[model samples]
Target: MSRLAVAGARHVVTVDPDDTVLHDTTVVVEDGTIVEVRPASAGPVDADEVLDGTGRLLLPGLVNVHTHLPMTLLRGLAEDVDLQGFLTRVWAAEAAVMDPPTVQLGATLGALESLLGGCTTQLDMYFHHDAAHRGALAAGSRHVTGPVFLDGPGPDGLTWQAREELLRAWPAQLAALGGPQVPVAALPHATYTCSPERLAQVAATLREVAGDRPALLSTHVSENAAENADVAARYGRTPTEVLADAGWLTGDLPVVVGHGVHLSDSDRGRLAAAGASVAHCPGSNQKLASGALHWEAVRESGVRLGIGTDGCSSSNDLDMWQAIRQAALLARLTSGRPDAASAHEVLRAATLGGAEALGLGDVVGSVEVGKRADLVLVDLEQPHLTPVHDVHALLVFAAGRADVTDVVVDGEVVVRGSRSTRVDTPALLARARDRAAAAGAAAEAS
Candidate 1:
């Protein structure tokens, strides 16, 4: 086990409500867990490596609670298409051409991009998710994967059996990788894509496989107006209500809903009662012209909120900084109040809230003793982040991905000077370029 220490930080935002910020601090990590967080004046402890965080802001690594990482291969491919067109004409078509190798390469590129941009963890849902998990591990990033479950045939006619096989195979793979923290879960793509019976079966399987173990269950719910209307028309209830009927929205299951653009008040109540979280993909929603999620309502109803970039195909990037800013701006716009969403709230949404949504709060969210040592150091000496009045404000508004100086996950430094430690960036970019061209050709043919 490698022991590491980050010392002499100007400020450390712990994100713990009781102890929000630690000034002039040193955080010590041993064997992947945080060992001590003391004043810088306390002197150094034993460690193999040390990170000088002078003139930097140390905080918990940003968590992206929802994303389709493999869609990095499809970034900018459907730029002009609306949500429906993007889904049917571009996304579906491109997915057909994604074999295991292509999917793994795309996911590896996406993980590298995310790590370089200061995201240490992501909750990803997509097809070929075993490859995604492997890519995440190789990139030295923490990820919780929920393989997509559809009622009918998927791209390449993949059936539930394939998804089941992946799920069964991933646990041992993750264990072998020495990443026991990564959990594999079931993701019914959406209320529209999965039949009611199929959804219930997924819930049942998840319950069986994850018994007494904390697990995540995620899906897209009530994303578009048409989806809400369709669910209402079919089941005489909203999508949330239908999901509740199918045993999806229960207290025992740790559920996270993606998008959630058109949730009804009743749906919000149900989510609140069930302790379900919502992944607010503001960038993707704005880009796709999907209606904005009522952030105030969701928060007020006691739903845990986290920020996500969604998929690169819609959002165009995997930058969590951009997602945080967009989430704050959209919340303020939706509430028609400048003070509706605070900078600190948005920052929390990207970090601690995201960890809570993934049910990894106790282990990875905040910079506290006993938690995993996942941290990001932002260079505060930059022109854009100069004269920081409030650290949270600077992070939520002024800073960009370019301002990220270092990223550490599981006590290992995976990014230094805005570059990935585990991947060959030039090679990954070249492969992605080739795969993107092939994907584009396939979409056009379809």
Candidate 2:
């Protein structure tokens, strides 16, 4: 068992329901779980490793509830293209050229970027998700992966048969990890891409794999305007209504709907009633020209909200700090109310809210004793973050990715001094660059 201690932090934002902040505190971790969080008066306990959190703001590690990890290979490839043009020109081209090794390499690089930026956990959806799982493990970060299921064949021949095989193999693969194992979730892609029959099949597959245990279900919903219109045209119902009709909202299964930007009032009510959660990707939505999400309405409807970067391909970065800042700004802009989303609320959405969305709230998310010791230390000595009057405000508004000095996940120091401890950054970047060059060549040839 590994023992670690983090001491002398100016403030530790727990993000717990009580909104507690311990000043000049110390946190002790044993065997990947937090054992104690007390004031400096508790004294220094024995530990194999000691993290100096002096002049730093210690907070729970950020959780990204929705992302496409391997798409890091396609970052900035469609910068000037609209959503449709991007899907047709950039995404289609890259998907055709992405192979297993490239996918794994890209995912590994993406994980490294996330870790350096203070993200410890990410819920990822993409083809060849097994490689993504391996990449996350190799990077020493926690991730939940699911094979994307669509009506037609996706990259890597993600047909219905392949989807079933992936689902069947996921549990044992996760179990082999020894600890919590990277849990598997079911991703149906979207209502526009999957048929009603395929949606029902996805639900059945989730039930089969879960079998008296809780499971996660995620899908893109109301992400694009055309998707909403198409659903209504085909089924005479909204996307949420169509999903409900297909029984995708049933059971005790946890569902995370990504990009609920254009959800109607009834849809919001249904999501609240079904206890479903939403992943608000403000950066991606704004980048793709998708309308702003109704953050105020969603919160008032009692729906849990999590922040996501979506993917490097769309948002062009995996930095959760940027995502957090963007989410706060966008929420305020959309609501037209200066007090709509406070810094504290945005930070909570990035941490505990994301954990709840992914069904891991009981184990991780906050700095409570007995919870997993997944935390980040932000350097408060930076010029931009100087003279911090409000810790939460500085965290959400002023802090950038470079402010993340150290990150610990599962009692392990995965990132120290804003660098990855598990991965070779130079080698990973070289491999990723090589893969991207090869993919670009292939795209041109095709």
Candidate 3:
């Protein structure tokens, strides 16, 4: 039995049922599952691998529920634009250079960056999904991705029949592209890009693929006023109404709405009644000047809320720490209250909340015995993290990606000493720069 132990932690912030915090804890893992979380004073643990956690804070690895991993090549391609303008520019650029091999290259770079920054799971949405999945797996991440549906020939030039074939083969494809535990996920681009009929068909296909397993449906929803208006113009209904009409809201699968920034009062009620979750991407929303998600209203609506740093093209980075901080601060600004969203609340959204949003809550959300060991160690010995008053506050407000010292996914150390162990960092960055330059040239030529 493979065994690993992380001992002598200053604190183990378990985002568990009661938000338990243990000081000087040692967590033991066997064959990818956590077996014990004891105290440092309980003596040493025998294991094949040991990670010293002195002066470090252990946390459940951050989950990014909404991302386009392959878009790392277009990091700065669509700056200073709203959602509509941003999509137009990005789509044009994507068509210019987003082949499967390039997608794999960009995805590897993005996954390596995410792992080094302490995020271990990503629910990614993009075409050429098989390539994206392979790329993330190469970086040793729990990448949850599957077939994507689009009404017309999108970036990958897939037709309607090809899309269906891809959906039908998704389960086997996912099994072939092996990695850590990952849930089946289906992504429809958005209400504006896909018609209501196409959305229903996509839902049906996902049902066919999932069979007896739990699955999730994620899509862009109500990201901005203009998007809602566009959906209304096309379908005579709001994006929420369109999705509800297609049975996605009330379907057997749980829904994860990306950037519900313009959700109306009635819309929030619909999502809450259907038990759907919303991925609150505060950084992307603020960057694009999309309206803010009402923190108090959504909380009152009883909709599960998770935080995400949207695609690197939109948010410019997959830093869950920044997403956590932006979410907490935005909640205060949007609710006009000092205590609108607490540090613990936002941190939970990044960890357990995000896991729940992706329908992997029971698998990788918290630090519990029998759960998969996806964890992060934040070095509290930094000058900026000195004299920690509240652990949650320090993590949400003060800690940056630079403070992450080690990361483990599925009982294996993928990152140590703030570098990815599974990736060649220097080579990945070089390829990313070269690909981005080529994409720029291709776009200009087009």
Best by TM-score: 3
RMSD of each: 1.5, 1.5, 1.0
For all candidates in order, the CA lDDT equals 0.84, 0.85, 0.90
Comparing candidate 2 with candidate 3, which one achieves the higher lDDT?
3
- Give lDDT tens digits, candidate 3, residues 210-240: 8987788889999999999888888888899
Top lDDT model:
3
lDDT of 1 at 232: 72
Q: What is the lDDT of residue 193 in candidate 3?
A: 84
Segments in model 2 whose C-alpha atoms lie over 4 Å from true places:
178-182, 443-446
The number of clashing residue pairs in each candidate reads: 0, 0, 0
Worst 10 residues of 3 by lDDT: 437-446
lDDT of 1 by residue, 154-230 (tens): 77478878766655665555566665275557887888888787788888877777656677789988877888887
Worst 10 residues of 2 by lDDT: 175-184
TM-score of each: 0.97, 0.97, 0.98
